[model samples]
Structure formats: C-alpha cells, structure tokens
Target chain A: MNSSNSGNVGIVIVSHSPKIAEGAADMVRQMVGSAVPLAWTGGDIDGGLGTNVAGILEAIETAWSPAGVAVLVDLGGAETNSEMAVEMLPEDRRARVVVCNAPVVEGAVIAATESSGGSPLAAVKRSAEEFYA
Target chain B: MHDAHASRSGETPVPLTASAVLVNKVGLHARPSVKLTQCAKGFSARIELALAADGPWTDAKSPVKVMRVKAPQGATLHFRVTGPDSKAALAAVLALVHDGFGEA
Candidate 1:
C-alpha cells in the first residue's frame, strides 16, 4: 500500500462478468496507482454469469479501510446483491459502505481518484454520483 | 503579476490562460485524462479545458468530464484558470500537456 493511500477510502467493483470486474479494477489501478485500497467481485458460485452476495461481502472486506468503502456495480442484480452484502456486514461496518448509483467502470475510476485525494466516504460517493449529474 | 490596485478596487483578476498541443500517440486517453484531472484537483483554482479557445470548456478536475473531451493526438488543449492560484494552476496543466502526460 502506498503511504498516500493510507487512511483513504477503499473501493470495490462488482459485475456479472468476472472479467468486467477485474478489468475495471485494472483501470482503477492504472489511473490511481494504488492510491486507494481496491477490490472486485463477480460471477456466481459455479463460475457462471451472475452475482453472489458472498463474493461481494468478501470484496468489501478485502478493500476495507478505516476511512470507509465505496462500491460500484454493473446491472441490477449486481446492485441488489451488493446491497445484500452490505446488509450482511457487522452492524458497525454497515454504515461505512455505500453502493453508488453510477456507471460501474467510470464510477469506480472517479471514486478511486476522489478517495486517493483523501476525501471522506460521503464526498467520494458524491463525486462518483456526479457522473449522472 | 500581483496588482495592488485591482485588489484594492475589489475587482477579480483576469483568468490566466495557456495552450498546449497533445503530442502523445494516443492523445488524451484514459491514462492521460486521469493524470490531468488528478493534477488539476491539486490546485484550488478553477481550471477549464477546451479544444478551441472560445467555448465549450469542461472542468479540468472532473475525470469523467475531462475524458469525455476525447481530444485526439495533435489536438490543442486550451486552458482558462481563475482564482487566487490561477497562475500556478495554468502552468501545471501546460506542463503536464507539454510533458505528453509522461507517455511520450
């Protein structure tokens, strides 16, 4: 972890296709350069095109940071599963995670950049959501 | 270029301006746009970029907006920067473009 990423918000990318999720993560890495903690989850238990709440939970944990975690998802199923995953977190951890209603790849990139700047969770979420504005 | 009279008169200083051509092979693609936005966000000044000098400018600090500009190779990027740190902001953006965003 780069020292600049310390105490910055984390980010998670979720999609129905594992490749899409990983590719978005790669974009974030290229753009922000590990300036923020990042993780991704996709595919179903049988490795099919679907989303799994368990995977999302694990990703959130992997990208977890003291500052908070922001999640960007593709498609409706991914979003619902992410919400479920957020619900599954411990009561204390629930509030720190958010599922942004923004384009997955773009949102993740923008959110990661905002987080790298040491913006708080709410501000990161707002910045990512600005894509729709 | 501090003008004591302008400050005393409570009139805002004119925005600083500069232009740099995109020499990188891929122009202002994802990586370069990201670098530009990240660089722009570091300054407090309001920075905007456009392909032409006159209009249709976009915020330099917004990655999505900056990337959407889709400036191709050889496109010139015009910058208008305002606020107290306008000079530094304009210089930084010009330097980034002149450096080819470190891609060249």
Candidate 2:
C-alpha cells in the first residue's frame, strides 16, 4: 500500500513549535517540490509547546512511502516522542521508519534533496545525519 | 596547464577547477545553497568548494557544509572536481553559479 506512490523516500519534520516544523517543511518543499512525500507535526495535543506522539504517528502515515520515512526532530522530547511513534507502528512498517538524529530544518532539507534524487532510505538517513558530522 | 607527463606520474591527478562569483542578491543563503548542493550531487565526481584557489574545501554535495560556507554576495566560489565526470561536473557547477543560481 505504501509503495503506491513514487519510489522516493518520504520525510517528516518534528519540533516543539508548530511554526518551526512548518517552516522546515516549507524549506524542503521549496527545494524539492513534490518529488518526495513530506509532512510535519509539532506542539502538544493542546497546541502548546511540546511533542505529540500521536501527531508524529499521523505525520509518519501522511509521509509514508515504500522507500521509507526519515523523521527529523528538533529536541530531545521530539526525538523521544518520535521513537515512541515509530514503535507504535505495526512490525512490518516499523523497520522502514527511522528517527534521525539530525538538525530539524537543515536535515529535512538535505534529506528531501537526497530522497528526490532517487536515493534509498539508508542513504537519505545518512545524508541528513551528515548535517552534524 | 602543468606538464601532462608529470601529472600522470604523480600520485595526485590534476583536479579540474573553476571559479564563479555569486552575483545573486543574497549570495549562498539557504535557498541558493540548496540549489548548489542539488546541482553538485547530480554528478559522480568528488566535488569540493572553497573561498580561495587553495582552500579549506568542503564537500559540494553536503548541503550543511555548503550552507556553512556563508559566502555572501560577490564572493568568488572556487570549485575542485576530481572523478570520471570531473570536467562536466565543474562546468555544470560553474554554470549554475554564473546563472546567479537562477536568482539574479
């Protein structure tokens, strides 16, 4: 079912602030257009400053592709929540999603660029993580 | 060019090089840097960029490294490319920069 779209890997951006997540996704869109599936989520269920695992999971579904989804997060809480979200996926879908340890905005931009170029999931994750290394 | 015979015998092959000035209003900001890296990654060459001819070069395919260059308007971008497609890679990158990254 996830493979129905183009083979490009998908990207999900997570942050404590909804604005940050949206801004990062905007940057990715500006650079990559619709070449890759992309989504973003942030803030608590109440729309306050915090990470929402449920929101992240929904974002993962929205951004899902057979090439897999790379999740970029802004802070520790976002990372933890993203991991929880990944764990919530069914076993078959779980292995395909990764919570990358990368800078939220820059990583998303780079990851989307790489994914749009027909790179595989691991390569996309590596390229995003290269932001720090 | 340097002696072809000497270059062939040396451990290091002469890298194809080129330079282009960033004429765009904002220079290598986030948007332009993204374009630059995207173009660079289209080739198989080992491409690097520097502020000077002899430089502390950074990988051209890495957007984060390219963004950190922080090259403002009028700054000359020096490129060093080495690989099977080095010539074409250098030309493509120079063309993109000369086009003002499509922003000018």
Candidate 3:
C-alpha cells in the first residue's frame, strides 16, 4: 500500500480565533500526523469579525465536494459564523457541512485524523475519546 | 503542465498521486500543516509529498516531516500514494484543495 491514501475520510476546521485554529492543527500533528483529508476556516482574529463570511463560503464551495466536508469551530461567533457560512451554501452543498460539538482544538484534531470515512460528525464524536483524560 | 493538468479531472489513477496548493493566504502554517498531515495517515496507502520540483519529498503522514517542507502560500505540493484505495486518497486531496484549504 502507498503511504498517503491509507484512509477515505475528510476533515474541516473552523474557529473564531485564527491562532486557536492553527494551534489546534499543530497539536494534532504532534500526535497522529497526516492521515486524513483536512480543511479549516476562522474569524478575523483582530477580535473583530475574524475572516469574511463570504470568503469562508467561497472556500467551502471550492474545497468541499463530492463526498462532502466537515466543520469544527471554536465557541461563540465561531459557531454563529459557521452557521452563516453554511446557510450561504446551496442546498446541495449544505448537505456536506458537518459541525463538531466539542472544544475547537480537540474537535479539529479528531476530525482531521480520525478514520471516519469523511463524515465530520463522526470525527467530532471521536474527539470525545480524549475527554476521559 | 499538460500531464499535471490532465490528472486534475480525475483522469488516470496515477501511482500515489496528490497535490497541495496554497489556498489560505497564510499558507500551510503549523495548524493546517498538522491537520493536513493527520488526514494523510488515515488511509493505508503510502503517501509522499514533493514541495517543489527540486525540494525533498517526504511522508504525508508525518507532521514534523511535513513541517520541514514549510509549504508557504501559493506553494503547491504534489502528493503520491500507491496501493489499494489510492484513488480515494487522491479524491480526498482534491476536495481539500478544491476547498482552498479553508482559505479560498
């Protein structure tokens, strides 16, 4: 078997804090490394609105597809903003957006590394695996 | 360019092939890099990444390894994975990139 395509899962990360988003990704590398398909989005971080919602939408449209994509966001605006982004998508595309239910960092890592066959919700659930610690 | 472009349409199942283009303005920093690398480990396929034409190629499943590549904005990496389900890996990569790595 080749080294890269070992899994069929896909992942996406979103956050109100850009640092948090990036930081979370870094932590995952410390543990599992690259083993799944990953995507991410974040707010302006200027403590303002973060990034443009439209930009996030465009990224989602372009990056997510075929088998759909999942999203893991930080608290507060991250969740609301993610909702806005999801709403912007076409009905067909909206079907692919999977939002995570746990802390942003953990959710991002689990979704990115888990072997959930591209299902975001499942990846988020997998993130719960770390809670016992 | 021609051969590379041809593969974008889900053409021939090249041996362990994947691509990473800078979609986020910040490029593949610690966060995305880690996240990207994590996804690479999911599949049983053997994955390798070439940051540039002359750059060193490394395993997609390694974060520290991927970090060394230091993929910057607008920089694109070509990935190759062979073995069963390689096509699935390629598709997932395409989707992630097509999503602009979350920065489009």
Candidate 4:
C-alpha cells in the first residue's frame, strides 16, 4: 500500500533561488533534527528542466531507504517539471513518488523534520496540511 | 553608459554581478520573459543574461525580443548593468529573474 512508505520519507526542494532552497531546508533540519536529501534547481532554467529533474530523480533513487519519496517546488512551471518526472517513472514506482502541496522551502523542511512513524505519503500530507487549512 | 554611475560616486562604476533564483518551474518562457523585458527597458541599464554562452542584449521592454531566448529550468543567469541605475538596476533585474520573468 502507498501508506507503506510512512516508515521512511525523503525530500527534494526546487526553488527560484538556490539559497532559498538551501536556507529553507536548513530551517527544517534545525526543527526536525535530521538531514533530508536536498537538491537545487532554480526556477529559471537557462537550459531546461533536464538538469533539475535528473537531480531530483537521482536523489530519490538514492535517498529513500525503504518507502517512497516526495518532491516540493516553488510555483510556475514546477508542476510541469514534477509531472514530467512522475510520468517518466515506472507506474508502480509512480505510486510511491508524490509531488507535495507544501510551499517548496517550508514544506520540504516540515516533511523532513516531522517524519516520525507514518508513511511517507502521510507525512507529506501533514507537511502540506497548513496550506490546505 | 560607461560613466553611468561615475557622477554619483567618483569611483569608476564597476559592472556588478547580480543573480536571482527561478522559484517557479516553467521559467521566463515567453509571456513572462516579455514582462521582464518590458520592466528592464524602463531603466537606462544595460542588461544581458548568460544562460549558456550565446546572448543577444535585446530591448528588455519588447516581448517579441526576449521570447527569442529559450531560458529553461535550472539555469543561472548573469545580469550585468552599466547604465545610470546600474547598481540598483542590477538588483531589480535580479529580483525579476528570481520572480521568474514575472510568471513566478
């Protein structure tokens, strides 16, 4: 079940500014007390989404120990980028990967920091709960 | 443009490097790039973006002009100014870049 991933959760942050991603992740680290894998992809792609997309995919493949992984990004074409990544993954693996609703920086941190005993999906939902609320 | 800021500060106006993060994913594709160019034109600042290597310093205000450059994701653009507001101009451009050509 998708909930199976609640046991382990990982994050990749995409932002307009590299510093913001790094900075936001740092804040989450302090609050949660653990280091989630962090990747940098400025919103403005001078070339294309290939670099950032590749980095996130690679991070997920390596970072997650048991369950699935989550991705959070600033706005604009972030959805497109995330969607593209999701589409490329195998169908079964796709269920494990989810693009989160939390603000890229804040959401990633919260997800990473608050990861406790729930599935990765559950944790991701909680991280973005505030936004929906 | 050389003495753009010289009159204010006797020190020769050194071209400053300003950068912004592309918060969004789509980037300054076309519509947004147009908006960014328009804002850039308002200032007497000379701005150029370094995405790969080839660059054409087009009129910032003209949408048609900027849409030509295909700026994608994960691209770090270098914006330099040598005009009157070169210093502040760089900051503004950088902000817009971070703003994702206005789309973000």
Candidate 5:
C-alpha cells in the first residue's frame, strides 16, 4: 500500500520568518525524505517578517498534489492568510486543501511523515494538529 | 521485558515481542519517532509500543501516539507484535532501536 511515487498528500509551511519556514521544511524533508511534496513561504514580498497571501497561494500551488495539501502556519496572521489563499483557489482545489492549527516545526514533520504514507488530507491534518496537545 | 504471547492448544504460536532502551540522546522525539513509526508501517503485523515494561500500549504505526509517550533518554520501550509477520516486525524494530536510530 506504500506507493512512494503518487497518492501522497502535500505539505505547506507558512511562517512570519522565512528562516523558520525554510528550516521547518528542511527538517520535514529530512524526516519524510523525497516521497512527499513540501513547499514553504515566509516573510512578505519585501522580505520582512509578515504573511503574504500571494506567497502562501504560490506555495500551496507549488506543492499541490492530487491527494491534497495541508497548510501549517506559525501564528494567527499566517493562519488567516493561509485561509485566504485556500479561498482564492477554485472550488475543486479548495476542497482538497486544509489549513491546520499546529506548531510550525513539529507539525510539519509529523504531517509530512503521515502524508508520505499516502494518508488523506483530513487524516494528515488531524495527525499534525495532535502535536499541540 | 513483557511477554506478548498466549499459549493455545493449536495455533501458529503467540505474538512476537521485543524490548529496547531509548539510548539516543533525544529519546522518542521528532526524528526517532518518525523513524520508528515508518519502520512499524513497513510490516504487516499489528504493532504496539509501550512506554514502560508494563502497560499503556500505543499504536506503533502512528507518529502522534509514539511521540505522545514522551519517553526521554534511558526510558525503556516494549514492542508487542501480533499477526502473521510478528517475528519479522519485532526484529525490524529491535534492529533500528539497537542501532541507536543512527544517532551519535
């Protein structure tokens, strides 16, 4: 049942600091390996510490997988922007994406590992969010 | 170590089990938890990992439960495997744990 090539959900890491986003994604990549698709966006277009809707949208699109995509944000604004990004997508695409409330680093690693096992979007989100408890 | 077996008049035998210490400095955190869960998923048996030598078995296939145990360095974990490939599953888990999960 392990098809490393396809059917695995994708992951998006969003944070106010580009360094945190990139570092979290890198950690996830190390844990989950190349089997799962991962993307990240942090800081505004000007490279300041803030969330950007366009950047978040681009990250979701870049990491899009047929299975689905789980977006993990660092804080409140990032979560709001990530939700906006998901809303910007077509109805069909939006249905496959979920904004998860989880710690950026630990959640990404947990979500990526679950996604690599070909878990559905909801399951991946649930697994990642559990890290907060 | 706990015994994960039952004696029946006729059957393929009881479950296969293994126990190991959390030798890695980080214990069952992100990295090692991911590795152990992945290895558990590779097998067909129903595997569970317990934080101590006694109770509270968590599904080995789930990274969430594995990390929930909050096992620190020097903690002992018991792996209980059931199903057709119990022996193989136990062996795989022990091998990874014994290898220190590639930690220094």
Candidate 6:
C-alpha cells in the first residue's frame, strides 16, 4: 500500500459543489498519481451550496505538506472562506499557504503536477496560475 | 523548415528529436500539458515542443508554454531535446504521445 506521505507539496481544492471539488481532485490524481497530498472542501455544513471555514481548514490540514499547500477555489465566496481558513492557522504555518487566482480545475491539476515534482510552494502556485495563460 | 535551420545555427548538437501527433481527444489541455511538463522535468536535458516540425520552440518544462501551442487532436508536435539526458527525454515523450496520453 502506498502511504500518503509522498513528501510532495500539498493541494486543497475548494468549491461550492462537492462533486466539482472531488472531480477535479480526481483529475489531479490521475495525472500526478498518489505521491502528492490532496484534499478538498465543498458545499456548506448544512449540505448547501456554500463554503464553510471549518471544512476548508480541515481540508488544508489533510493535505498539509512540509513544502507548503496551495488552495484553489471555485467562486468568490469559496475564495473568501479559503483565505479565512488560512488566517485561522498559526502565524508561522500561515506563511506556508497561498490562495491562488486560477480556475479551480485547471489550477488544481497544474498545482498537483508541479507539487508532485517536489517544487516549492511559490513555484507550484505560479504553475497553477499559468492556467490563465 | 526555417525554425529548424535557425536551431541548427546555435551549434548545439540536438542529439534527440521526435514528432508525434496529438491523438488524445482533447489535445494538449491542462492535464496532458501537466503530464508533458512532468516528463520533461524528470530529465536534465533542455526539452522543447514546437507546433511544427521546424520552428519556434517553447520550453517543454513549462506547462504554460506547452499549453501555448494549443495543439488539438490530430495536430502534430515536434520535440527537440539537448543535454546529457536528451535521448532519454525524447524517448519518453515519444512513448507518451504514442500512447495517446492514455486518453485514446
């Protein structure tokens, strides 16, 4: 069995729909394999189409990598909640996280691929943002 | 043609070169581009992929540049590699492309 501790940079996908987040993560896994830590948070606590801070925070923890974690959100509310989740982390830990401005699916795919290559947090974020190009 | 000649002017011995058609249904989209970049990174060579057989080349290590080619299904991609592991890099890319990126 392959343990989740592959040492690659981690990735968190935030989306309004659980399906979207999971589907995107699936694509990432298919491309990069299981070497990178990956997690997703979607919908609200009540099963509504909204973003939840706790869920996002937990997702971040699930995918935390010593290299760092990059968060990709689908919409504005998800983006806002993702930032709040990062802020909730310890100050030192917060520095290791970044919220990227890119399409959720494409960003997650690129970020996962870059992270699996043992890239640093910033470079992973940059590669994810390259989706805009 | 022109780009191939231009590349030769550098006097760099490009010992590895190959061309493949994009057989995947979606072509060089985000996922495939990621796969291509990751493969290039595994080698120490300077890898490049171009839209034509001979011309301007973009760093294959850059997912953004790989996506810039916007290669669609049936579009041909040319790969040129230089460095110590150039041959290995070219072989890997050719195999991946031949497999249709596992999307065929």
TM-score, chain A, candidate 5: 0.94
- Stretches of candidate 4 off by over 4 Å are A1-7, A35-40, A43-51, A117-119, B1-104
TM-score of chain A of 4: 0.72
Residue lDDT tens for model 6, A15-38 = 999989988888878877888889
Give the Cα error of residue A53 in candidate 5, in Å. Answer: 1.4
Q: Which candidate should be chosen as best, given TM-score against the real structure?
A: 1
RMSD of candidate 2 to the truth, in angstroms, is 4.0
Error of 2 at A65 (Å): 1.9
Write candidate 1's Cα lDDT for B6-95 as tens digits.
673422377778899999999998889889988888888889999999959999988778888999999999999888777778888999
Residue A104 CA error for candidate 1 (Å)?
Answer: 2.0
Off by over 4 Å in 1: A1-5, B1-12
Error of 1 at B67 (Å): 1.5
**By DockQ thresholds, what CAPRI class is model 3?**
incorrect
Clashing pairs in 2: none
lDDT of 3 by residue, A1-133 (tens): 0112433344555666566665765665454455545555566745554655764565455435455555666677666777788888888878667666666666555555544334444443454343333
Cα-based lDDT at residue B84, candidate 4:
63
Q: Which residue pairs in candidate 6 have backbone atoms (N, alpha carbon, C) closer than 3 angstroms, thus clashing?
A: none
Per-residue CA lDDT of model 4 for B1-104, tens digit only, reads 65654566632266656655555577656445634654565566676665533444544543334545566667666665676677776777777777665454
- CAPRI class assigned to model 1: medium
Candidate 5 backbone clash number: 0
| Candidate topping DockQ | 5
lDDT of 1 by residue, A44-90 (tens): 99999999999998899889999989999999999999999999999
**CA lDDT of each prediction against the hidden true structure:** 0.88, 0.87, 0.60, 0.57, 0.85, 0.85
lDDT of 5 by residue, B51-84 (tens): 7656688999889889888889888889888877
Going through the candidates in the order shown, the clash numbers are 0, 0, 39, 22, 0, 0
Candidate 5 residue runs with Cα over 4 Å from true position: A1-6, B1-14
Better of 1 and 4 by TM-score: 1
Each prediction's Cα RMSD? Answer: 3.0, 4.0, 14.0, 17.9, 5.0, 5.2
